[model samples]
Target: MMTKLGPLLLVLLLAGPESSCGDNPRYEKFLRQHYDNPKSSFSGKYCDSIMAKRGLTKPECKEVNTFIHETKNNIKAVCEEGGEPYGNLRRSKEHMKVTTCKLKGGSTRPPCKYKENSSPRYIVIGCENGWPVHYDESQIVTTVDNADLD
Candidate 1:
């Protein structure tokens, strides 16, 4: 993470378009550096405020982004969950526990809206320093895996 522009571009090219989040280690590093939850409840308003504070509100707005409260080591271990592959990106089964988030309707401009949906499901994340730093949107396997534990 916090890699130079050249390395970032290289990683993006390898990750492809679908690998929106967690494609760039810099962004992952940014998330780890700025957004780690413990203070407030992980609610919709929390997503809105954090996204804006993290500079994810520029241009249009990030429609989807997940912030995991668990330790980075636990999150990174998800990659080895033996899930299927998603395009060229690495993915895990719908077993890893996570709190998912999406922007609510009418969230188009500044002061974006977000709705927090916490559940256990297959998640894709990028790792740095042997820790999962960013959640990848392209690699989400499923949301309907009710068997996932809370």
Candidate 2:
């Protein structure tokens, strides 16, 4: 009985420390040291004075705020056509082709065109044209797999 009890006690002692590790004590300590613990930079001079007063650092607040702002921007851009924070225009999935577009006077690299992949494959559009106009089946949106797009 004594021998069996000794093994059980050792196992319990070893497992106890591992269970506490799941709390991410290392990460928590790091966060407290840099962002939350004593003399937090967010205090008084920053936007969230209460949090700051409680010892949140300026960098910590800034990181969280920036992440929120970026997430909002991404959501907006993914759904809408204009005023995206990243300034990338939303494009249609069809009715456009990648072709060499030439400038009226100067030479430009191959440009995207409003044309179908078959039957007169290339139809040039003005550089300032925002999006391609639909004319025929040839004017199909270039397909990209989600993984490739990413």
Candidate 3:
């Protein structure tokens, strides 16, 4: 079942300062564009619908983008607790579900095309004012020891 953003979720996403860790405009944008907690099921055309629904295809198709599937709180915990800081980017301590979107054949035209890859990997988020501002990167989680995955 595809969960469209609306109703109570809209209020939560568009909440005021009284909300929890995600209280800023950048955090809202990040949630709208990248964070998909109850994400859509993966398919060959996943990127096209998902990105359009998330508003990433608006001012021209984004070259590449990644969607993270995890609770907002868990994503924040990466920065607050076990995350390692590398300047403005912080790497998540746990491997997460993510789908990366890339432009197909280098096309930038309307009805933008994309290819997707879904896997377990560690993600990085840009932190600003203690909120996740944007997705920075994700590295494949090697099959090493759990504690040594980093």
Candidate 4:
């Protein structure tokens, strides 16, 4: 589970040392929604909207952008090969190349055909216009999960 940031942090970033009325409740609500689901781009948009409405000066928009960029980099780094293959997936209509990933607690050499008998852990990164239209995996699943061969 993701740990949530508190309203105190939001207020500190926005209003500073002043506790005023008229907008405190709204600010608290916005902070709660944002911290609860920072991964949602729609939530980011909502935050931008709130900032516009409040006419308050806060780094909410900038924070959202930075958060997204950093998270993407972390995901890319998970599959990097000597920092060369950063898993920079690109949006495509068709699936791209299948490069073998270094499996967990396993041999460093490329997975053999016999070893490619199970589902590989992968993260779908590239999104076409904010929607994931395609995916390229390091390996493919041979056995179907919960398969209904009827």
lDDT of model 2, residue 40: 26
lDDT of each: 0.58, 0.28, 0.76, 0.30
Order of quality (TM-score)? 3, 1, 4, 2
- Best-fitting candidate, scored by TM-score: 3
Q: 104-133, model 1: which lDDT tens digit per residue?
A: 776567667877766656666554443445
Q: After superposition, how far is residue 1 of candidate 1 from its true place, in Å?
A: 34
Pairs of residues at least 3 apart in sequence or in different chains that clash in candidate 1: 94-122
* Model 1: residue 31 alpha-carbon error in angstroms: 3.8
Give the local distance difference test score of model 2. 0.28
Which regions in candidate 1 have their CA more than 4 angstroms from the true location? Answer: 1-30, 33-44, 79-87, 126-134, 142-150
> What residue pairs clash in candidate 3, if any at all?
none
> Taking the tens digit of each residue's C-alpha lDDT, what string does model 2 give over 42-113?
333332343334343333332121001122222222234422211233333222222211112232222211
Error of 1 at 128 (Å): 7.4
Q: Tens digit of lDDT per residue, candidate 4, span 36-96?
A: 2223334434333433343322322222111111222233333333122223553222222
Q: Which stretches of candidate 4 lie over 4 Å from their true place?
A: 1-87, 90-116, 138-150
Worst 10 residues of 2 by lDDT: 63-72
